[model samples]
Target: MARESFAIGTVRIRPGSARALELPITRLVTGADVTLPVRVVHGRDDGPTVWLDAAIHGDEVVGVDVIRQVMGSLDPKAFRGTLVAVPIVNVLGFMTGDRYLPDRRDLNRSFPGSARGSLAGRIAHLFMTEVVAKCEVGIDLHTGSDKRSNLPQVRADLDDPRTRELAEAFGAPVMLHAGIRDGSLRHAARERGAIVLVYEAGEPLRFDSYAVEAGVIGVRRVLATLGMTDEVSEPPARPSRECRSSGWVRARRTGILHLDARLGQEVADGERLGTLFDSFGKTLNAVYANRDGIVVGRTEAPLVNSGDAVVHIAS
Candidate 1:
């Protein structure tokens, strides 16, 4: 049987073809239209439909490059099933290099939204109905926020066998069994029976080469595992760590932050990770790990306020 056309908005791609389309969102005050850019690849053969999205937080640009790499290398004639990719989800924020929308709303926290709702809510609703609803699997790409840097990792529900299998196939440095957040895309998609994986790496607003390479490689690995395409399938240098719980180490005293701990370093409980120094170089307070865990994320800012999250440990 001939494959039917894959449609988004008013754009339709036939089997073994690809096309670029735009989803119109609200407009700016200058009367300019803000549209979400999308790419669709309809494979010649039938297989699982998968979606790749990024930059729900506009400051995170690594996923934008990752999506470009993945979509640029695909050959619809050799690929199987449909591939829906939205490289930049928050168009307005992306343009201004901000993390949230103009209304100061986090797009990630507004999902399964309504058509007549707020701007973020309406975009979420459009994405859910037009893109995610047609996909059997999804990979949401992200990076660390608020001057933090994250080691490349995949966060998902590891209890499910299939999701676990795919997470293993992704080949990130760590696989954390993370739970769902209210109004998150992961939560909404899972509720609709789609297997979702969230890939976190690098820092917001900058592209880390290592993190981007790992993400591209891991994404290709997942596609290969799903029989979508025979792309690169080499395993990572080391096996991914399976972490069940993780927490952030916060600053006890506001001061100039100095950290000696490195990403991927395994720290023992009670070990001093770093220290806080006053303006005159006096040690105000010391930071210590409360549990034995691997250092997966840490702040890059030189100064921190009291109770600010400084390091992220996963165990």
Candidate 2:
């Protein structure tokens, strides 16, 4: 058998070898060109090519560590197919710890980007052309934003059998069937026939050990499930729960919030999840679940405004 080789931009990676390459995006104010860093691991054995990208939202940094750990564990000689790991997708936002690019556009919503478009759009287009389009599957990692913390969970279009299988194989604590949002990487990737899974966990800008561990393990499990590798570093400790729908429990009035329910905890419909109290200690309101489900996400910040989302329940 002949050795297989993969190409991304000007870099060529042969089977049983690995290479760290950069794809140039655009120039900054200081005339410095920004680039996307990519690590390509081309296994000797023939199999599927998968891409793992994290930190599309610069503040969502947990996935960066997850990808690092995952990359450390993979060996090209023993692995199958190709593994493309990109720890940071939004270079500008990541540099400044902002969720959006310098242009204030959400990178997650600028997929299938155009070369002549905005910064986010160009980056998205570059990613789609140089990375995502080269793979058969993808795993886009993310964390909750806006002071929110999410229980380790996989959100994907469960209607697609292949995608659903990968989601189940990911083994996050919970799986939510999410729809494709316009301009999202998930939406663009699927349109191009790549089975993708979006893993959400932890909180933006803050590291959670459990969420990080779950994410690392989930990516490996999905790799095993795809036959890209037979080795799974850590099997899921518990079975994953599935939900077809979810809604947020919002605050009725602005105040300091006291949450009673925890992530991954089951809650019944109308159960009190938390309370809001004004500065004067007056009870403002009590937040309750609208349906029976697991508490998948909640705000960690104590201060909130009226109608702020407090809890996310998947039923």
Q: Top model by lDDT, which number?
A: 1
Superposed Cα deviation of residue 253, candidate 2 (Å): 0.7
Q: Which ten residues in a row have the lowest lDDT in candidate 1?
A: 230-239
Tens digit of per-residue lDDT, candidate 1, span 1-315: 979999888888999999999999888889998899999989999888999999999999999999999999999999999899999998888989999998899999999989999999999999999989999999999999999999999999999999999999999999999999999999999999999999999999999997899899999999988989985648777878999999999998999989999999999999999999999999999999989999999999989999999999998
CA RMSD, predictions in order: 0.9, 1.1
lDDT of 2 by residue, 1-315 (tens): 956589999989999988999999888889998899999999999889999999999999999999999999888998889999999999889899899988889999999999999989989999999988999999999999989999999999888888888898899989999988999999999999999899999999977898899998899899898887886766667778989999998888889999998999999999999889989889988989999999999999999999898899999
* TM-score, prediction 1: 0.98
Residue pairs in clash, model 1:
none
lDDT of 2 at 157: 86
TM-score of each: 0.98, 0.98
